[model samples]
Target chain A: MSILEFSNVSFSNEGKSILKNLNIRIESRDYISIVGPSGSGKSTFLKLCNNLISPSEGNISFNNKNVSEYNPIELRKEIAYCFQMPHLFGDTVMDNLSFPFKIRNKKVDMDRIKYLFSLFSMDEEFIDEKVLNLSGGEKQRIALMRTLMFTPEVLLLDEVTSALDSENTLIVENIINKLNNEGSTVLWVTHNDEQSIKYANKLLTLENGEIKSLEVLK
Target chain B: MNSGATLSTSSLIIASSLVLISLFFSYYQKLNLEKETIIGVIRAIVQLTIVGYLLNFIFGLKNPFFTTLLLLFMTTNASFNASKRGKGIKNGFLISFIAIGIGAFITLFILVVSGAIKYEPYQIIPIGGMIISNAMVAIGLCYKQLLSNFKNKREEVETKLALGADILPSSIEIIRDAIKTGMLPTIDSMKTLGIVALPGMMTGLILAGTSPIEAVKFQILVTFMMLSTTSIASFLACYLAYKGFFNGRKQLI
Candidate 1:
């Protein structure tokens, strides 16, 4: 079953067409990369998927259900989005990671948090450190870990590694590849062709608010 | 008669010096605050003069109702000033009212019940002034912080919402941080009160013929009252402001 589907989606802000006649689909476990220039509506597309922005026209369905029919908050749990610039709250790293669980009233998965931290090569001691004191790389890792805590069925990554150094970028890219291999549905947006080629199982190229090309990678 | 004459002359000298010094600082320092300084100095002089006469009458009458009315007027005006400073905040007046009302009442009741302040107009007026002024500062700071946090961390807030967090929890940190930042000025003032500067209450008490030790004691009491009132007001204002930032369904406005 297609986990996510966008059919003839159109969006405009202030009567200016930001997205027009865009269509795409994500099968279960598919790692899709959306490549486009800045203002090509890549972020807008992700936002629509996450219901941050409603489409101006056309329909979006998730798991064969109309996107509008699902509660945005519930839909968000199933489909988490990572922003381009990670913003951590004025709290400890542990608080940042456990916020999703705390909000939902779920038990803190300490093991999973530890595992994610180890995977990102972060120190366990960082859990007690204030988020304000964290380096950029540490913040990005903590932000990703926070999003992943809920184990969302699909992850919408919007330039998640764009602000990171090359070393940190590699760490994130490796994690993305691992997540994809482990059967997570990933929709990633980036202008970096190399990152797209590295992890994308399916590539969707957008231009002028429309998908110009769709290619399946081996 | 000699003491009275000395007090009057000293008051005039102090008032004039404050005005001249403020003007000189505004002009020579090129602080861009010349207009505000001039207006503030003029307003202070006029307002204090009026209040001085009013206080003479009130002290003579010493009626509880009039004192209560005066307290209410001060709280309401302070709350109004707070709301004005918190522009772009919806229903800010309501938030300020709740903040000032809760903060002032709690602190004043405690002070009165503890016998720190008598139930008379003299004690109530000064105590009310302390509470209301701090509450005003607290509300203003909390509102400013909340607005700035919302502006800077908007995406993070949206991200939380998209991650199944409700509006309240999503905004809890912002509100908490804002309140903390808002309370910092009050905390700093308390810390620097005697060593760095003599607070208005202490200075006023001393000028009114109270001994230094007595003036210091009153200042300490007022500081404690201000701290408690400001904290309560800031917390209430922040919580109320958060509600205004959302819709009926708790979605961000």
Candidate 2:
């Protein structure tokens, strides 16, 4: 069975169509990179996968069950959604990072946090710094680290590295690639065409809310 | 210069002419408010005269049933007016009604139980009017604050939701801030009470032959009641109303 499937899904907001007739079957560990012009519904497609927004018509199933059937909190946790512009709340970085563990009633593992910091080339001591004083690149990385507090089954990234410098972008891309190699289904949306094809096994193009093409690159 | 404790009917009529000075100024200044000022003056006299007679009759009867009915009537009217501020929230009228009703009931119950005021028509009617009207204002402020916070902090709340937090936990910060916003005005007013100006009820009591000390004591009780009612109403209204900002999918509306 496919890990995620959208069967004839259509979405419209305020009576204007945004996405229509999106049919796709995602397999486990399949890294799918989506590329399109702005307003081609790339971000909308990623949001649908995380159950952040439901289809106005048709069905979306996660793990062979209708996505609506799973509790929204549980579905969002399993299919993590990282936004284009990162927003880090609370006073300190640790406040944002430990939120995932706080919600799940689980103890946060400092070792896992330190390990992610090492991968992202961030100092472990930066966790104590105020979130407001962090640079844009640092904030995005910290936001992504918060999302990764528990490794998700599927990671939905919508232009997650848009603010990052080349060096930081490379760090994020490599870390996400590492997560993909470890059996996480990845659906990433990027405007940078070169970056889209650099890491993913398959590439999908969206045009005016419809899938223009899907190619298995690997 | 009447020596009567109450103003004579002719003296009251003479006092009514004070509005013409307002009308003369409006006309002289080309403010275009002469008509409105005359209409407002006429309406005040008519409305207050009617209410005065009505209260006199009601106070004479001292019927608990009528007193409760009048309190409910005031609360319903207040709830309707307050709900107008809650434009975005679904079923705003119902939420305002419940919050204001509960706040008024809890405050009035305590006042009556403590013998601060009787359940009589004269005492409860005035006290209930003050509590319900204050609750209405507080609820309006809470609704506005909640709507603003949800709009301004959409991304922040969604960030929490996307990380698996439920709606309540996601909205807790906004809710607390909104309640604080609703209650802050009452707290500030209490700080400036006697120094800033004489409050309406205390001034009225002193002018109506109550001792200044007695009026001051009543004002203190009322100041305390306002603080209690506003906080309770704001807290309840915020909890009930925050859900309106989100949909069943746990997404912000």
Candidate 3:
């Protein structure tokens, strides 16, 4: 069964059509890289999966149930979205890291956080560091780590590594790829063509709010 | 000592020349406010003259129906002004009316029931005007803060929303900030009540030959009621006005 599916979805914002009748399906563990022009609805497509903005026409389904039928909060938990521009929450890195647990009414998993810190090659003291002083690449990594705190079934990456240098990008990619191998579906959107084909098994290209091509890279 | 002190028409004419000083400053500084100063003075004279005769007639008549109608008119006018300042919020006038109306009503009800003031037109109209007017200003501040905060903090809010937060949780910080913004002025005024500036109502009573102690009593009453109404109004307005910024999909509009 497909983990996420969109059927005849059309989205319009402020009288301008963003995405038009997009039909998509992704199985569990599918690493799909989406490349598109700025306004070709790349971020909008990811947002729709999480029900951030509902389609004006047709329906989106997660786990074979209509997305709107599920509580939006619960659905968003399963489908975490990482934005293109990184914004750290509150003052310290601890705030963003503990937020996912706080929202779920669960205890913060310190050991798990420490484990994540090692994966990103960040020192443990960075937890208390103020995000205001963190570099853009560092902030982006923290934001991604925060999203992964709860281990969502689907991780929607909307150019999350855009701010990262090549070294940092490779570090983030390796970490995220490990998560993908563990059965978390990854739908990454990026403008870099080489990055699009580097790891993902599938590449989806969009132009003018319509899918231009889909290829199985593997 | 100054009770019944009246300004005759000729006396008023001489006093009116004081406005020329402001016009002179505007001319010297190139402020271009001469027209505004002239219009403001004329409007003040015209509006206050009408209100004075109307208040005199209404006070003498002692009709409860007229008093209630006048209070409603004032509340509606205050609501309109507050709503006009909030162009972004949908149904701003209706929201302001409900928030200010309820806040003013609760404060006035307590005052009337406690025998602090009578429901007569003389007392109720002025007291109601003060309460409703204060509520209007607080709600206007809340509206302005809500509009700006939602716009400026869009990424933070959406990040929370995308992280499985309900609208209230995602918007909680902004809502609290807006309520604080609305209520801060009243709290600051409370701190400096007697020390910084004499309140308009108390000063007027003193000018009209009321005893200093009596004027102080009324000022204290006004101060307490203003705090009560603004706290209630700011809370209600922030909670109610926030939903306007979110769409049915729970996305920030």
* Best-matching candidate per DockQ: 2
Candidate 1 per-residue lDDT, tens place, B1-253, comes to 0024145677777668767787788799898897998898789879998999998789778999999899889988998999999997888888898889889999989988998888788778877887898899889988888888888888878878867787888898898898897788889998888889899877877776788998888888888888899899999999888877765434465
State candidate 3's TM-score: 0.91
Question: Candidate 3's residue-wise lDDT over B112-142, tens digit each?
Answer: 9999999998899888999899999999999
The TM-scores, one per candidate, come to: 0.78, 0.96, 0.91
Span of ten consecutive residues with least summed lDDT in model 2 chain B: B1-10
CAPRI quality of model 2: medium
CAPRI quality level assigned to candidate 1 from its DockQ score? acceptable
In candidate 1, position A114 carries an lDDT of: 89
Give the alpha carbon lDDT tens digit for every residue of A116-215 in model 3.
9999988999999998999998999999998888888999999988988999889999988999999899999999988999899999998888988889
Q: Is candidate 1 or candidate 2 better by TM-score?
A: 2
User: Each candidate: what lDDT?
Assistant: 0.85, 0.90, 0.91
| Structure candidate 3, residue pairs in collision | none
Reference-based lDDT, residue A97, model 2: 88
- A best-first ranking of the candidates according to their DockQ comes to 2, 3, 1
True contacts kept of 1: 0.66
- Deviating ranges (above 4 Å) for candidate 1: A1-17, A21-31, A54-71, A87-95, A114-142, A160-184, A192-202, A213-218, B1-42, B53-65, B155-159, B243-253
